[model samples]
Target: MIRLHHVAQTRSFRVLWMLEELGLDFDVVPHSFFDRSLRDPAYLALSPAGRVPALEIDGRTLCESGAILQYLAETRGTLTGTPEERPDWLEWLHYAETVGSHVANLTQHHIILRDPAMRSATVMRLEAKRLEKALEGIERRMAGDWLLPSGFSAADIAVSYGALIGQRFTALDRLPKVSAWLDRLNARPAFQRAAARDGAAQIYMQAFYPPPEETPHA
Candidate 1:
């Protein structure tokens, strides 16, 4: 049986959406970032870093979400894209983390820090700008409806996770293609299914977390 450890609105959502896209029958082992459950020894055994998206499949467990997506696509013989497009596919897949890093920093400053004093307005503004630039790269690279010219592939599912969440910290107004692409992704049936199973909002209580206003230096 395939089992996926998931937390709503986390990077694990990438794996959850991927599983739905592949039409795989799997159980979602729900987890929370608020509770100390992730720190437990049992969960850690599955994910050494105490992170989400730890998947149990084919008699072995996988931790990283990107790796899981590649394994599933290759083993299932679908969504891997054409062999000639492998380089682009792999590049987009890993680039998801570039977008994610900014989101993580923004989330930490905007949400996880709890006390306002503990959060750095400078970091928030900087990360938001960085996230916006990363998304701009996606917009510039979009020559079609999806990341790859070969149509929808696992690369879309892998990288879109960041765009989906990054919007909270960074506006997509100028990135029209990225916004349109996100709309198309949200309209997918598999993406809808994953959203239904995404559990409750344990994090990101606000609809939008705007970056702090820029301080003018004298």
Candidate 2:
């Protein structure tokens, strides 16, 4: 059975959601965020980064959320796009990873990482602006849905987690196409089941409402 090392509110959600899409039975291994237990020596053996969403599939371990999604999609053959379309496919993947990484960093440094007395104002503002630009770029590319010309591939899965979960940033209002895409993704039965299994409905709901902007630099 496929076992997913899941940490709630992390990129692991994307893996869980994809497993749901595949209709495959899997086990969810829980991990905590407050500590680096995930980075323990044994776990690190499987995932050098010591991050969540590591997968143990029939005794083979795999890490990195993006790689995990691509593996599952390829194994199940639901990954659309071919070698002829490889350029666009790889482009979409990079776009997803690039945007998501920037946004997540912004969220972490600006919002989640708090030491009110020692916060870096300049870093906060810079990350926020960078995140804004990244979102704008993503919106432009997604004007035509599904990331690539082929529609609904692992590329979408890679990007959707950030789009779906980045509540600390601005809402998806300006990016109506991406906003609509989020709604459409949530509507899928697979998404629903995965969310329920992961018990992430409340977290997903919370993501819909953006928190008040509290830029330390401002």
Candidate 3:
């Protein structure tokens, strides 16, 4: 059986959603940032970085959600798109991390550093703007219901993972197309199934984490 080591509401969700989309039967081995479980020696062997979404598939191991998704597309012989469309497919897939970087920074400011003194106000504001700028690219590019004109692909699964979490940091009201795209993604049954299996929230506890203005309040 395909085994997925995952952390709820993270990049691992990309793998979970894609697996559901492909109708592949797999088991979810949930992990948490709260616990030291991910730092365990065996988990490190699966993902040297100690990151989640480590897949034990076909008797091999795969980490990195983007690589995992691309591998699935290759094995299933779909979602990667034709030769002409491959570049665009790859762009958005990696761009997911572009978006993820800001989210990670913001998550550090607004959530990870529980003490207000531990967070940086300037960083929170700067990262939020950077995140919004990255999202604007998606807004301009989203001329259709999905990221690729060829229709739904792993690119969507890869990129949209951030949008789901990003809306919490940078408001999507200004990013209407991306917001609508997120709605479409959320409308998918497979997305729903993966979400149902995604387990309860861990890192982010609030619906919205507005940018930090001024300096840290003492």
lDDT of 1 at 105: 92
- Winner on TM-score between 1 and 2 is 1
lDDT of 3 by residue, 104-200 (tens): 8999889888898898888999999999999998999984998888799999999888888988998988888998899899999999999999999
Provide the lDDT at 63 for model 2.
Answer: 86
TM-score of each: 0.97, 0.84, 0.96
User: What lDDT is reached at residue 187 by model 1?
Assistant: 99
The models' CA-based lDDT, in order, is: 0.93, 0.72, 0.91
Model 1 vs truth, CA RMSD: 1.0
Tens-digit lDDT string for candidate 1 (110-196)? 889999999999889889999999999999998599999889999999889889999888888899999999999999999999999
lDDT of 2 by residue, 1-218 (tens): 88888877778888988888777898998887667788689888878888888999856998888778777877788764666776776676667777677667656655466676655656656665666677677778773666776677777777877776663566566778777888888888988887777743322323332333554665
Tell me the lDDT of candidate 3.
0.91
Residue 79, candidate 3: C-alpha displacement in angstroms: 1.4
Which pairs clash inside model 2?
none
Lowest lDDT sum, 10 consecutive residues, model 1, at 206-215
Q: Which candidate leads the pack in lDDT?
A: 1
Clashes of 3: 0
